[model samples]
Target chain A: MKNEWPLWEVFIRGQHGLSHRHFGSLHAPDAEMAIKNARDVYTRRNEGVSIWVVEAVNVSASSPEDKGAFYEPSNSKVYRHPTFFDIPDEVGSM
Target chain B: MDKDLFQYLLRLGDNTLVLGHRVSEWCGHAPVLEEDIALANTALDLIGQTQLWLGLAAEVEGAGRDADKLAMLRDIWGFRNLLLVELPNGDFGRTLMRQFLFDAWQVINLGRLMKSSDPRVAEIAAKASKEAAYHVERSADTVVGLGDGTAESHARMQAALEYLWPYVGEMFVGDDVDAALVAAGVVPDPASLREEYDAFVGRIFATATLEMPESRFTHKGGKNGAFHTEHLGHMLCSMQWLQRAYPGASW
Candidate 1:
C-alpha cells in the first residue's frame, strides 16, 4: 500500500518575506499528503508558514561527478576581472 | 480542589492528553514512514503541554501531586476536555480535520490566555500559542488541499468534516470554570471566540472550494464528565500502564 505513492522534496518558508528553503523529503500518498507530512515533520517548532512539495522525480540538478569538467575553465579567466579600472579620490569609497 | 481553577486546568490538561493519545495512535500505522515520525512528533508536543498544565493544576489544588500522577490516575469523570479531542482518528482526513478545528480554537484561546492576569497562566499560554499557531496553519493547509483535491480526496474530506462537526460547538461553550476565568479576565469569553474562528475557517474553506456543512446538532459531554466514546479507555491503558504497573517507578 505504501508503494502506491511517490517521494517528494519539501521546501519551507519560515516567514512571509522569506524564500522557501529545502527542509527534507518524505513519501506520501499524493502531493497534498506530502505537504501535510512535511509540515508535521519539519514545522512543529513553528518554523514555517509556507510550504512547497514537489515530486522528487520532477527536480533536475547538475550531477556531482560533472563538477570539475563543467566549470573548471571559468576559474582561469583572470582577464574577465575589472580590477584594472581607476577611481577618483573624490569618490574613494566607490 | 479549588473547583474553578481545578476544572480550568483539567480542561487544558485533558485537551492535551486526549489529543496526544489520538496522535500517538498513528505511531506505527501512519500511511507512510515519514508520517509516522510526524504524528509522533505532534504527540510529543501535546504530551509536553499536558504536563505543564496538569502540573499547574496540581499546584493550584495544593495536592502534593505532579503531572504524571494526575495523568495516570485520573478517571473519566475527572477529565474536563472537550469531546472533539477524544474522537477516534478515523483516517488521515479525519485526523487532519480534527487537528485543524482544535488548533484553530487553541490559537484564539491561547492568544487571549497570554494576556491573562495570572502571570503563570499567561506565560504558559504565550509559549504554547506559538506552537498552536503553526499547528493551525499546517492543518488548515492540509484541510484546504484535501477538500479541493481529487474526487476521492474530496469525499473523504467531506466525510471527515461531517463526522467531526458535531463536536465543534463544545469547544466554545463555557462551563462554570470558564465563566469565572472570563470574569477574572484570566480567559476570554467563549462566545467571543466564534466570529474570529469562523472567519479563519471560512477563508480556508472558501479557498479550498469546499462547502461548509450547515447541520447545527452540537454534541456536548466530555467536559461535563460524560463519556460516549471508546477511544479514551484504550488510550489511558497505554498511557498509564507503566505508572500503574510500577507505582513510583522512574527512569
Candidate 2:
C-alpha cells in the first residue's frame, strides 16, 4: 500500500497580508490535494484569499541549535526597524 | 397554512436535515483531518438549512411546533427526506459521491425554488441555492480526484457510484406531494429536473474517468413518507436520544 502521504507546508495571503504567510502543514498525496487541504484547513473561516503549498521535503531549514549565532546577531540590529527613520505626519499611516 | 406547501417544505427540509445529520456523522471519522473539517462544514450548512426549512414547515403545520420539535421528535414514517440522504456513509468515496449527486440536483432545484410564488419558499431557496452551488464544485472536484487517482482509489469510487446510483432515483420520484406544489408554482416538478441532473452528473463522471453503471433499476419512496431502509432508524436513535431523555432540555 502507498502509505505516508507527503507533508505539505501551507501558506496563505489573507485580506490583510500582502504576501502569503505560513499557516500550517498537512499530509496529502500531491500538490493539488495540498491546495484543497489548505483551503479546508486554513481558509474555512474566511482566513485567506490565496494559498501556496510547498512540499515539506523541498523546504530547507537551518538547525535550531544555531539560533544564537544565526538569528540573535540580527536582533542586535535595531536599525532595520522602520521606526528608526524619521518620518513626518504627512507620511500618513505609513 | 397550505397543506400542499407544508408538505413540499417538509420534503425539502427533511432532505437537508437528514443529509446534514448523515454528513455530521463524519465529524471525527474522516480519512484525514482536513476532510473531517470539510465534511463537518457541509454538515453545518445542512443543519442550518434544515432549521430554515423545518422551521418554516412548522409555521405551515400551525400546530405550535418549532424546527427543533419537527426535527427531533418526528417518527421515521413522518419524515419526508429522500432515501439517498439517509443512507449510511460507506466510506469517504461513497460519502462524496452521494454528496455530488445530491448537490447536482439541489443546485438546480434551489435555483428554480428561488422563483417560487410564495415569498417564504423563494427566500429559503435563494440562500440554499448559493450553498448548493459551492457544494457541487467541492464534491465534483473530489469525485474527479478520487475517480482518477490510483487504481485502488478508482476502484473504490466506482464501487461507491454503483452502490449509490440506485438510491438517486428516489430524488425525482413525484406524486401528490409534488403534484400540488408543482401546480401552484411553489416548486418544480422532479421529473423536469432529471435531464439537468443527469447532464451535470454525467459531466463530472466523465472528468473523473469513471464509467457510468448500466443499471436501470432504482430505489424509490423517500418522499412518500415511507422509508424502506434501516439506516434512518439507527441514525435517529442516537440523534434523538437527548431529546427523548429530556423533553425540554436546552443548552
Candidate 3:
C-alpha cells in the first residue's frame, strides 16, 4: 500500500532536565499519532520522559551540496572558541 | 485455596492474555509502520499485565501451574475473557474501535482496583492502570479521528462500533464469583463501573460524530466459562499449539 501518511521527525527527552534530542523519523497520519508512534518506536524501554514530534516537511535543513559554504567559514574564526578566555580561580569551575 | 479469588484472577488475566494475543497478530501487518509498532507496544503491555494477574491466580490455585502454563495450557472452555476481546481484527478501524471500547472500561476498572483490600491486587492494578490510561487516550483519539474524518472512514468506524458493541456488555455482567470478591472487599462489583464507562464513551462518541447504538442487548457467558464464541477455540489452536504439542517445553 502507498504510504500517504506524512513523515515526522521524533525527539525525546531522556530524563527530567534534559533537552529533547533527535531520535528518528516515522510516518503518521498526524502530529498526535506521530508522538504516539515516537513513544512506541523510540521510548519503549523507559528511554524518555518527554517527546516532541514535528513534521519532516516543516524542518529546514541546509543542503549537503552547500556544506562548504554553510560550515567551512565558521572553522576559520578562532575567537569563537571560549577556551581562549582566561578565568580567575575565584570563578571556580568555569 | 480461595476458589472465588482464583476465578476472579483468571477473569482479569484471561482478558489481557486473549486481547494481547489478538493485538500481537498485527505485528507485521498493520496498515502503517507507526500503527504496527503502536499495536505491538500495546500488546506487550497487556501481556505484561497478564503475567501478574495469572501469576497471582496460579498461586491462589496452589495447583503447581504458573502464568505461562495458565495462559498456554488453557482450552477455550477454561478461558474467562470477555468475548469482546476474542473477536477477529476485521480491519484497522475495527481493531481500534474494539480497543477503544475495551480500553475505556479497563482504565476505569483498573482505577477502582487500585483501592482493593488485597495489597497484591492493588499493586498490580496501580501499575497496569498507568498503561491502560495511555492505551485509552490513543485509542479514543484514533476512534475520533477515523470516525469523523471522511465518508469512507466515518462509515467504517460506525460499522466497527456497531459490530463490537454487543460484546461489550459481558464486561459488566457478574455473578457469584464477583459477589464473593465484593464481600471480601477484594474488588468492586463489575456492574458498578457502567455509569462512568457510559459517560466516558458518550463524550468521545459525540466528538467522533458517531451515534451510539440504541440496542442494549448483551452477549454473555465468557467470564463464567459457560460459553464462548467459536473464534476463541480457533485462536487458542494457534496460541496454544506449541505448548499442547510439547508439554512442559521451554527455551
Candidate 4:
C-alpha cells in the first residue's frame, strides 16, 4: 500500500464559536479520516465542539534555526511598543 | 421482597464493574496510545458508575453491607450482569464493537432512568448518561474508521461484529427486575429502545461501508445466572481479592 498520505495537524474548539486551538497531529489516509482521527484523539472528554485538521505538509513556518534573525530585530524596535506613549490624565481617567 | 431490588441493583452494578474491568485490561494494550487513554478513562467512568450503583444496592438491601463487600464478597453466581459484558474482549475491533453496543444502550437506558421515581437513581443516571454518550460516540467513530479504513481493518471489524452480535440480544432481554422497573416508570422498556439503538448503529455501519450482522442465535445466560465464559472469573478474582482478604478493612 502507498504510504504517502500527509500528516495532519489537529486543532480543536472547546465550545461553540470558539477559535480552534492546536491539539496535536496524526497520520491519516485522507482529509476525512484526518478529521475523524482528530475527533477520536482530541475530543474523548467532550472537550471540543469543533475541529480543524490541516495537512502538515501544506503548512509553512519560519525555521527555529532562523529565530534570531527573524524575531530579534523586532524585539529592539522600541517605537513599536505601546508603552512609549504617555497618556493624558483625562484620557487615563476616561 | 426488597431483596429483589438489591438483586436488580447488583445486575446493573455487576455489568458496569465487569465491563469496566475488561476495558481496563486495555489500558496499555490498546492499538494506539490515545485510544489506550480513552479506553482507560472510560473504564474509570464505568467503575465510578458501578460504585455508585452498588452502594445504592447495599443501601436498599439493608444488609449492613457496603459496595466493596457486595462487589468483592459475592460469588460469581450471585453476579447478575448481562452476558454481553462478560464476553472477553477478543481483539481491538471486538472491544470497540462491544463498547459501541453497550454504550449506545446505556445512553438510552440512562437517559430514561434520569427521570426515575427514585431520586438517587435519577441523579446517578443523569451524571452517567453524559459520560456514556461520549463513550458511544468514540466507539462509533472507531467502528466507522475500522470498517472503512483498510481491507484488513474491515475484515477484523466484521468478524468482531459477528462475534458480538449474538450477545446483543441479551441486552434488551427484560428480566423480572427490568419488567418491574419498566412498570414503575423507573426505566423505559429496554425493548422499546432497541429499535432506536439499531437505527443509530445502522447509520454508522452504513457510512462505514460495513454490513450489520444479521441476528442469529441469541445468547441468553449471564442475567439468568448462567456463566459459560472464562473472562469473568479472573476479573472477579482480581477485583474482589483485596476486599475479601481484608474484610471490613478501609482507608
Two-chain DockQ for model 3: 0.83
After superposition, the stretches of candidate 3 with alpha carbons farther than 4 Å from their true spots are: A1-3, A75-94
TM-score of chain A of 2: 0.74
lDDT of 2 by residue, A1-94 (tens): 5677899999999976488999999987789878877887888788998999999999999999999998998988898877877788999976
Model 4: lDDT of residue B226: 69
lDDT of candidates 1 onward, in order: 0.84, 0.88, 0.93, 0.83
Best by DockQ: 3
Lowest lDDT sum, 10 consecutive residues, model 2 chain B, at B220-229
DockQ of each: 0.42, 0.53, 0.83, 0.24
Worst 10 residues of 1 chain A by lDDT: A1-10
Q: Could you tell which candidate, 1 or 2, scores higher by lDDT?
A: 2
All candidates' chain B TM-scores are 0.95, 0.97, 0.98, 0.94
List, residue by residue over B29-107, the lDDT tens digit for candidate 2. Answer: 9988877988888898899999999999999989999999999999899888888888999988999999998999899
Candidate 3 chain A weakest ten by summed lDDT = A1-10
**TM-score between model 4 and native:** 0.85
lDDT at B193, model 1: 96
lDDT of 4 at B112: 84
The residue pairs found clashing in candidate 1 are none
Q: Candidate 2, which segments miss by more than 4 Å at Cα?
A: A16-19, A58-94
What docking class should model 1 receive? acceptable
lDDT at B239, model 4: 76
Show pairs that collide, candidate 2.
none
Q: What value of lDDT does candidate 2 attain over all alpha carbons?
A: 0.88
